[model samples]
Target: MLASILMTVRKRRQPIIRLALSTMVAALLLGALACSPPEPVRIGFLGGLSGRVADLGIGGRNGAMLAVEMRNRQGGINGRPIELIAEDDRQDVEVAKQAAGRLLAQKPEVVIGPMTSAMALAILPQFNTAGVPLISPTVTTNALTGLDDQFFRVVAPTAAHVSKSAEYHFRENGLRRPVLVCDLRNKAYSESWAGDFRTAFERLGGEIIAEVGFESGQSLAALASSVLAEQPDGVVIIANSVDTALLVQQLRMRAADLRIATSEWAATERLLELGGRAVEGLVVAQYVDRGSTSPAYLAFLRAYRERFAHEPGFPGLTGFDATNVALDALAARSRGQTLKQALLTQASFAGAQSPIRFDAGGDTRRDTFLSVIRDGKFESLQ
Candidate 1:
């Protein structure tokens, strides 16, 4: 009788034991679910971060990074943090292709840059194949403009910037004859910019005396001499900041009073640092208005200075704006909505310095300002 009773008791405890085991498993799973972190939204950045154009790349990268950091602090997109992956294209076509391949492998929601027009053209095909959109901070070549492809830029096209500078040179600056020094390294941008400037300036009765083309490593002294051979009243330089600064220095050594201007591509903090007095009167168009008292711009300037310990310049400002546009679209996109579709759905986005609006072809325009380097600063040309 006692053995039977014991057996009955054991049978009753079986269900309890099973129930306890199931409960423990449920508790462990819940604990794990609570402890695990959420997935991050991946974003990619591509630029020539280690070459002659590194200043622009580094500035752009830092700006994107700062935007991601700030957004993550504010609870991120739908509670998921953002992860920015950066690649240096080294300003080489092969390197840019490899970098794009590496960035695409990670499956980013969007990419923020190629910095220059050449890099954009180099890696655009790969990004299109992967169905990823490239939101460039500074690639303004007309070749990419009005394309319904996977490319979009925050700044206007080459014509928008160069034409304005051309008009300013012809009508306002009273430069009747000018020579162009084109950098062949960035052939796409330099050529497009020079072509537009030529059209605009010539239409305005200004003459281009000569066009001197050179690669980056060529002798700036010889190039300067060639430019001086034309005996032009003014000079326009289309090159990177480093080369532009060196060429300006070379020209200054020969003709102290020659009026000089450069493409906005060469307008960076490095130009002032390297060119010093030579770039003092150098005129160029800028995407940002430095004299603005806008709260958004002031906040960005302060944050950028604090984060990077320096000025953000054009690249940084555009980088920040481009990344924010991506993030806004990412946050607002509905289920099953493509990133391109999401971007186009919005009427406009608020930029750090100004409002940004895109056309149906994913082309946007910013207010370009004509500024001259004065007292080691970019001052508005009144």
Candidate 2:
């Protein structure tokens, strides 16, 4: 009887051991599957995040994020979630090159932004070599206009707007003698803008009193004093918002009745906040018409305000447009077509600011507007 009882006990324990072993094997398989990598469609974003030009970079990054979020919410590209790898170049050329390399390492299908023309030029070789399409949102230099590379921009070259501005000031405003002050730090855009404006103004029977340049980390007060000494009828300031505001403040302090105009680069809201009353009545060229009532523009404005808790400026608008271009290309790719071919074939992209139609040189023709700062807001002068 004792032997029979022991045999029953051993048989019951044998089944329990088998059951525990089976549970352990199943858990292991589940864990392995959980640790597996996810497949995602990647897009690389590079811009200056920490530097004097951080505003532009931050705006661009936010815009790109908005695009990514909107696409993901709408089921993403062919059900594969889109990923954005953002890198800060700190507004340095070498840093931009390294950042481009790091972004390219992930093998992203497309890249968006370097914010400035200099950074775009620095990182162009990397994207071109890797055969990745790069869409620059705010690079306005004419240097890359006809380059047969993968680089493209949402904004038109500086030549067009600056020339128009020159005509507006000389022929319309009757500002015959103007002084040109440019920041060498962003020579890629500023220099081009100043040069184009000078050419156009001179051609339109206006005189450039003096052309002065200020480098980064230099004293703006002295530059402003020197420019004031020229007693120009109107002044054309070609610098970013920060420097532009400083120069404007200095100029206004010295001469209360001074007339000032600026390039599109310095036409952000930050300029009004920084320059205060000094920027009032200041003429500036802008790529976006703030008075647009289009459905696309209004929708973008609403979404941007909700996400970022503020208004979107040129940088934000252009960034959003550039990313949309990239997303459209990605969508085409999902249907077994390539983004490059679509872009080169003159893809029609409806942007928040305007309808985009790429030309043979991969540049878009945008309508720039003249605006003046009135009561700390941009009022269209056109």
Candidate 3:
């Protein structure tokens, strides 16, 4: 009778033990789910991450990604982590449109950029319709940052900037009349810049003594001769910096005494590489100092060299500084809200660059800096 009772007790306890084991397993699963982090704050970087301007896009994304990583390390925004989504626009307009659409579908907090002017123009209308803010690292066309408040570009609008700088260079050098040598028949940068410069110069008591245009992949020595025959006080040449160097070399071959009063884009290492000492007497307007050699710049150069196996290029540094500022804004923004409001509330933003306080229209009315090439290098002309 006692043996029968023991068997019965063991059978009942076996069921209880199984039930307890199942409850423990369920509890463990629930605990793990609780420990998992909240949904990540999504940010997308849209740029020409492939093709010709890939260097610029890659550098910009690096700075932005670094900012996101740093923020995540210190417990993210409102305790939610950050994630960056990047795509290559290939520096093509149609591709930029498709990439922009793809990124917007991900429902990111903010979209970083579509770098070039063409790309920016392609994405602008879509971003405007979606009410999504596109913080551009580089689109510097004057018509872009127009009456619309949504067009926020970190790069100085080249057309307006060149206008003022051209006026200054002309007046300071006492160049009354000038010849407008343009690469309009070919390069996009040349046509727009030449148009803006001609208008600005004419408004500032300067006459266009002669006008000349060239086709892409083709250079003419005769145009330089045409410009010289007019005997203008100085020559205002507008072309893509790389092509500009080729034209300058050809122009210098024709006339040893050519003095230029021109725009900012001409100040790249590309010009010096092609034209060499011929570019020494050349004056240019610059927003960034190539010869900065400051602590921040030096540190950036070192880091860039480490990652890229080379020094930073012109647009690379600009894109780096610009994207980093936006990322800093993201990290410092208020929690529990979309990034747009936080960016709008930022009264003042600072980075390795100058203090960037966006106006209502998101354009900077900043003064232009001048630089003169000396010894095959750039020096700020204060």
For 123-227, candidate 3 gives per-residue lDDT tens digits of 889887876778876566666655454567676666657776667756786777777776542234555666777788778888877777765346456666777
Better of 2 and 3 by TM-score: 2
Ranking by lDDT: 1, 2, 3
* Index of the highest-TM-score prediction: 1
Model 2 lDDT tens row, 62-161: 8999999999999888877899999998888988998999999999999999899888878898888888889988998989898788888888888756
- Candidates in order have lDDT scores of 0.92, 0.86, 0.69
Q: Per-residue lDDT of 1-382 in model 1, one digit per residue for the tens?
A: 9999999999999999999999999999999999998989999999989868999999999999999999999999999999999999988999999999999999999999999999899999998899999999998899998888999899999877677898889888889999999988889999999999999999989899888899987999999999999999999999999999999999999999999998889888999999988888889777788888999999999999999899999999999999999999999999999999999999989899887888887889887888999899999885
Top candidate (lDDT) = 1
Report how far off residue 310 is in candidate 1 (Å).
0.4
Per-residue lDDT, model 1, residue 171, is 83
For model 3, the run of ten residues with the poorest summed lDDT: 183-192
What is the C-alpha local distance difference test score of candidate 3? 0.69
